[model samples]
Target: MRTHSHPPGHPHDDAHVGHGHSHGHGTDARRLGIALGITATFMVVEVIGGLVSGSLALLSDAGHMASDVAALALSLFAVRLARRPATPERTYGFHRVEILAAFVNAAALLLLTLWILWEAYTRLAEPSEVQGGVTLAVAVAGLVANLVSAAVLHGGQRDSLNVRGAFLHVLGDLLGSVGAIVASLLVLGTGWTVADAAVSALIGLLILRSAWALLLDSLNVLLEGAPRGLDVRAVRTTLGGVPGVRGVHDLHVWAITAGQPVLTAHVEVAGGADSAEVLVRARQVLRERHGLRHVTLQPGAEGQPCEQREDLHT
Candidate 1:
């Protein structure tokens, strides 16, 4: 509606927040940063314990924790970077940095899962003696730590991808820790060291499931796909229904940052119209009806509208 001139070089996020101040995103980033620091410190403690305990489950859990530390660190870094103003060289600012980091964190976990499977395969070929009691204790401690980290991040992750990545990292650690504990009990009470490797393999399967989804989501963002939850058809219909708008085209929706969605489109009206007024109305509709803020629309198309060739192929 009303155009407020930002300081000339200020970076803008066309993602979820629209043209409003990025203060909310900044505040959320700070919270995730604090949670990550806490998570990283405890992760180190768990890794050392796993190594000393001589338990593969504990070690596996520690591996997961190690990844969690890396994920959290990336998220923390992303939050800070996302706040930096945009330059002509990088106009969108650093919002998508969080998404890139998310992809890295997830890919790292998937690679680690493959490594775990390979290790489990080797162990299956030649089973080793495990210190089950020690493994159990370490696993318990790791579980407690993971639970704490998950709790700290739970609130924000639903709204922020940086926090969600960190949360997923902690959740994966929790799964590994629990598997380690069960394997330790089976080994100590029933003399089933093979169960340890079996459990690790199962945990690897779970990680694969998670990693596939993360990779796909991250790739979608990189491809500039429409933001996950937005409906393009609905958006087009809504725009066309506007009083002064006869058609809408060239509409695009994508992430400018992890949790931000940006939209750009063209509107065509049948008669002469005011671009400013149409822009104002379009902005209002996106924000109020669609929960979208980062929208750029050019009004007035007297004749034919834009068409997506991809649609014709379908």
Candidate 2:
């Protein structure tokens, strides 16, 4: 017998797969809008400040802030798209759009960082005059703006990869602002204009670190990899241990998005065991022990060969 279980009101409904995530969509959209506004407003200021101060650190931070604006806007659009209801053709709705957005944002950040590093290297080779006093004043202002933007996105980032990508961009800008300030101080105190190029290079490296992590996480989701921290072998072992179950096979687990995991498996029942009872026990174990609410199971007598192709077995 083949059986499937999902939360009440949505049988085999991919739309309702992640119940925990539904409640936060509205709040997440609101937060993204707020952060987007803050980031867009400051990006212009940073650009003009970079030109006036002639500081590579300031220009690099301004470049990062520009990318932040684009990242925040994309993240906001993804969050809204993800809220759309599922369709017959697109059973999972637009949830994957958020993952795609994160991937794009991470790639853009990586490219921008490389550009900043290259510019910094050139500036270091041939030092440029930077107005320390002006750079200091503008960098301090940028620091304040980035702090507010980072604070706005921090709450939602833990729950959504889309939000986390935007948060990382804002956080990178925050660090860049700090680096610009430090470089400005070094130039003012010791007349070492090279400090600006050095600081810009450091900021680029920091951005590379955060962007790489976001890229890998979003890529994992896009590839339908198992949810992070979930152990497929452990899940198989636990399911096999269920009372009346003779064995487990052809088991599979993968995520639809960051927090939603779906599982399917074939279970062999012991001789003379009730298949219905075995199915119920298996469902209970997966739900209680593994926190899996979306599941499908096929149960048969121990001696029966699985009808599925052997190559499909994991």
Candidate 3:
């Protein structure tokens, strides 16, 4: 017999499927708004400063700040969208919007970094005069603004990929500010205009590293890969070890979004075993051992014909 059984009397049920979507997002939205305002205001200033100073480092930092403005705005929109209730046609609601925003932000960062690198390369070939005094003053101001924005977003970043992407952008801008400051100092002290391009290139490399990591993480979620640090083989082994279970197959695990994992499996019970009791124990094991609360299990007798294709077993 095929039994579609869930854990009975479990506190976590379908109602809790999108728990993170509702709670704590208000704080996150507010944080994003604060960071957005700060970043937008400074981005314009940095652009003007870059133009007046003619410092490649300052110009590259301004470019990154521009991308930060966009990233923060997108993150704020995604946070609001994620609050929408699930509809019949869209069972998972708009949670994935956050992941999409993160992906887009990462892509933007990568592109901006590449552009900065190219610009720096050209500057290296034919160095230009940079106003070290103006660059230093503007870069210090930008650094202070970035510090405030980064602090505002840091609290929410660990909980949401959308927020994390914005945080990374702001952090990159912070590094760029530091690079600009260093370049300005080098130029003022030793008349080495090449420091401007060299420092800009270094900042681009740093941003590239962080952007690539965010891109991969968001891509994995979009592709429905298992959550990070979760082992499918370990989950299967645990299920097969459940008392009265003859075998386990058709097991699948994937995240709807970060911190929200879902699993489904087919379990074969020994002949004459109490399927209901076996299911309860299995659910308890999964919940306690593997932190899997959102689960669906199909229980059947040991000799029952496999309803799923053999190739699909994990």
Give the candidate number with the greatest lDDT: 3
- Which residue pairs show collisions in model 1? 1-280, 11-86, 15-260, 15-261, 16-260, 16-261, 18-293, 18-294
- The sequence of per-residue lDDT tens digits that candidate 1 reaches over residues 125-205 is 888888887888878877887787778778777776666777777888889889999999999999988988899999999
Model 2 residue 163 lDDT?
Answer: 93
Off by over 4 Å in 3: 1-8, 308-314
Displacement of residue 314 (Cα, Å) in model 2 is 21
Record all residue pairs in model 3 with backbone atoms less than 3 Å apart, i.e. clashing.
Answer: none
Q: What would the TM-scores of all predictions be?
A: 0.85, 0.92, 0.93
Model 3: lDDT of residue 51: 96
Give per-residue CA lDDT, model 3, range 58-108, as digits (tens): 888888888888888899999899889889999878889999999999999
- For model 2, name the residue pairs that clash: none
lDDT of each: 0.74, 0.85, 0.87
- Superposing all C-alpha atoms, what RMSD in Å does each candidate have to the true structure? 5.6, 3.3, 3.1
TM-score of 1: 0.85
